[model samples]
Target: MLVDIHNHILPGLDDGPESLEEALLLAETAVANGITHVIATPHHRNRKYDNPALAVKLAAKSLNEELLKQSIPLHILCGQETYFYNEMLQDLDGNLMTLGESGKYLLLELPTNYFPAFIFDILLELQFSGYIPIIVHPERCEFLKRDRQLCYELVRRGALFQINASTLVGENGLTMQRFAKHLIKHNLVHFIASDAHHYKNRPFLIKSAYKYIQKKFSSQYVTYFMENAKHVLEGSVLQPIPPISFKKNSTKH
Candidate 1:
């Protein structure tokens, strides 16, 4: 099954769909794009939105029921796209939701403009506490885009990277697309998710992105992402793919 590990499909939660109809429409689009499952990762602890675990679970359940009623053939699981904070451990202890609610993988978002100095320590702590942190949309982060070594270090230290499908297709811009491709070429990317928020502009791009990857890279690369998604949902160890080093000064436009 094609699973989207990151998305904002839950209605009235964050900046995703605003109503049930919009949510259903997004689900239809996702199903049409060959996505069978999506984790409704509403924003949590972000300055603008804060959806707690129990509340996101309830919303996901409601959306699932509506999908069943509408015969959408899509499943919504609970998750959170949490902004990194020192209190993440405490929040997890107090019932913060992990990706797919599996408790094995957590979807984390860093600031787009800069990387926090404390993130390394926080990632280490989370891993030590038994939760694998999956950094969301790193290609779009200006700091990481400027310094590929930061990404390598995070992945080297046991953190997984999730790239947005939109970035793969240059929807965000050419720079992000290049970085997304770089991450994939070097085996630094572990998951590819929609990060979809609406039915139109930020719609599900998994099918298109996978097609691009298959054509540009190889079928095995596509399978790599798919297997990683499966392992994430199963809370099992992912298949090993050796990462290659980024060549020096290779990110120039």
Candidate 2:
């Protein structure tokens, strides 16, 4: 079964669908695109949005009931795309919902354009606390885009990376598309999720993204990504893929 480890399909949560009707439309789009299960990762403590763990779980439960009532055939799992904050560890001590509520993988979103000076320390702390930090969309972070070797360093430090399907499919532009491919080729990316918000604009393009990967890379890589996402939902430990160093010539655009 195809599982999407990230998305904002929950209604009235964050910047996703505005109402239950819109959310149902998004779920239908997911099913048509071949996604059997998707984690409804609403924004958490991102300054503007504050979705607590229990709230997200309740939201997912309600959405699931509605899906069943309408026979959508798409399952919504509970999770959060928590923005990095200094007090995050304290907040997550018994709070923040991990992907699938499995208490293993946490979907972490860093600042859009830059990584905080103490970002590495935060990731290390999370690791010591028995939680694996999955960095969402590093390809779009301007800091990582400019200093691509940071991708290798982050993976080496035990942080897994998830690239958005939009980036892989070039919807976000060619620069992000190339960076996404670069991470995949160097074995730094662990998952491909649709950080999808709406059915019309930010749709789930996972099927097309996998097809692109199969054509440009190998079926092996595609399988690896899919399996990693499954592992997140199952709360299973993933054997890390040792990252390949980027040749000096390939480090920058």
Candidate 3:
């Protein structure tokens, strides 16, 4: 059973599926893609969106009922894709934004082409607050493009990095694709999430992504992703896969 740690499947809320029908379709697609568990990571703490915690809970309950009614076995968990802001700590304290479904891992989304000077310090702040921060899609961050060393430094400071599955396939572009591949090959990537948005633009799927990782890398790494995700769900201790050293690029393209 594969667990999708990041996705926007919650219905009629945030930027994901505009309607409940689309939400159901995304959920169906998730099931068809061999995802037994999915976390509905609605954008929070950035879009100034309302706290859909109640709505998400209701959606999960209804979806479970309907799935059971149709005899389709799939579980949709609840989470939030929190954006980086100064008020992040306040939101966490207020319980307006949650981490992974189990509340053990916080998915922190950074700016597109800009990173604050205090980014590392903020991560340490989150850790000090007793919440594990999973830096979402660091490959897509402009800060990383300018200074790849920062990513390595982040990992050293007890921060986990998540690479987008589609980026690994070059869906975004060549640059991101190469960076995504580099992270995986170097063992810097700890999670591979869909970060899926709508159905057409960024569909909710994981099988191809899983296969890509398995074929390009070792099956053990795939299992490693699965094991770490499972540990997050079970609220167990999430350990890093030994320290990884970034490969020094020798060729000057």
lDDT of 3 at 15: 80
Which tens-of-lDDT digit does each residue in 1-253 have in candidate 1?
A: 9899999999999999999999998998899899998988999888999898899989999999999999999998888999999989888876587788787999999999977999989999999999999999988788887878777778888889999999887798887888888888778999999999999878999999999999999999899999899887778878557777665545553
| lDDT of the structure predicted as candidate 1 | 0.88
- Per-residue lDDT of model 2, residues 164-247, tens digit only: 999988998998898888888788999999999999999899999999999999999889989989999899998877899775
TM-score of each: 0.96, 0.96, 0.89
Who wins the lDDT comparison?
2
Worst 10 residues of 2 by lDDT: 244-253
Q: List model 3 lDDT by residue over 63-176, tens digit each.
A: 677667776667877777777777677666454545445556878888887767787778888788777888898887876766666677788888888887788777889888
- In candidate 2, position 57 carries an lDDT of 85
**Root mean square deviation (Cα) for candidate 1:** 1.3
After superposition, the stretches of candidate 2 with alpha carbons farther than 4 Å from their true spots are 247-251
| Of 1 and 3, the candidate ranking higher by TM-score | 1
Full-model lDDT, candidate 3: 0.74
**Cα deviation in Å at residue 119, candidate 3?**
2.0
